[model samples]
Target: HVTLVPSHPSYAVISENKRQVRYQAPIHQPLVKVKYFYGVLGSPSITSGKHYWEVDVSNKRDWILGVCVSLKCNEKWNFLRPENYQPKNGYWVIGLRYANNYCASQDAVKYSDFQDSSRSTPSAPWVVPLFMTIFPNRVGVFLDCEACTVSFFDVTNNGFLIYKFSNCHFSYPVFPYFSPMTCELPMTLCSPSS
Candidate 1:
């Protein structure tokens, strides 16, 4: 079994056992700054080979799970911004919002010239819907460094594929990331076999 690290409390409120984390303030709370509720990265970044991990998000209202570049404790980045979750920023994630929508982040594309096939336009990164399903109690993440792929599975449903990010460019070591947004329920890291 691999060890899983919870998010740092400075970025979010981590549980005593380091198995769960939550944003301190709710979205409707007054004077609550979004910057105070950033997500956390797991320890022991993956350098090569295949690795798998699972997170228990049962009864959680909002959360995000996936892999990201290992950021130092002292390093500063605006994770609260929407653009920070894109591949260009070293974040490839799938998340469930309060409205029960599941989506994957992707870079936006546009056709600069309608008549010309070669001309294309670049826009901000955005998310695309994968499907509409109830959030799984336990989500499994499989990362294949050599294959440049990251896949998520619904552990509660016969290990069904939730989403997969293929052809990912890994310039640096990456780690598992988790964010339980404003939900009191803990997000526990589960054994891959479980």
Candidate 2:
């Protein structure tokens, strides 16, 4: 996620309307050992309270939406692989792929299990597959820091709940995540009135 508060992203192009971000091609091997795609994070990260945002995904099929838990990921990894994103890796996100497949990034183990005295391995990614009856034109992301939950709504279907992540341990401030994916379509950030 790009921290607009600090600086703008170099790999993604923001439209003149300032609502859409189209990521550019990958720079030959990035600072990290791997090559990852570009994505954006909204400014003024949420430390508390509830926050909601919507993305216009009417024409997009491959994308990712949710909240990112680690601001440090930008400084450390610079860019992250989608496969590395999980609750344990400081990302609570849902993704769409292959035009129809939907899934949420989950942890193989519970959060509290690691906090115990035993030094076990970190949580592995447990992607839960999701099936939607209707493809939403706009997806609403709601983050409740107090409840430690993030929920996604299908705005096109009377705000129906698509999926929700519970008992999230947000270590850092949460930032709204947007990944338009490598598709030809662009994802637009929706205004409150729209």
Worst 10 residues of 1 by lDDT: 71-80
CA-only RMSD, every prediction: 3.6, 4.9
What is candidate 1's lDDT per residue for 1-194, written digit by digit as tens? 44446433344666666666666654555865454336777767789999998998888877888888765223453135655677767878888877477888876555644546776655456688878455588899999999999999999887889989999987777888876655666778877755
lDDT by residue (119-182, candidate 2, tens digit) is 6555457779988899888988889999999999989888999899999998867788777666
Off by over 4 Å in 1: 1-11, 26-37, 71-74, 110-124
On lDDT, the candidate that comes out on top is 2
Error of 2 at 7 (Å): 5.9
**How well does each candidate superpose onto the true structure, as a TM-score?**
0.81, 0.79
Error of 2 at 154 (Å): 0.5
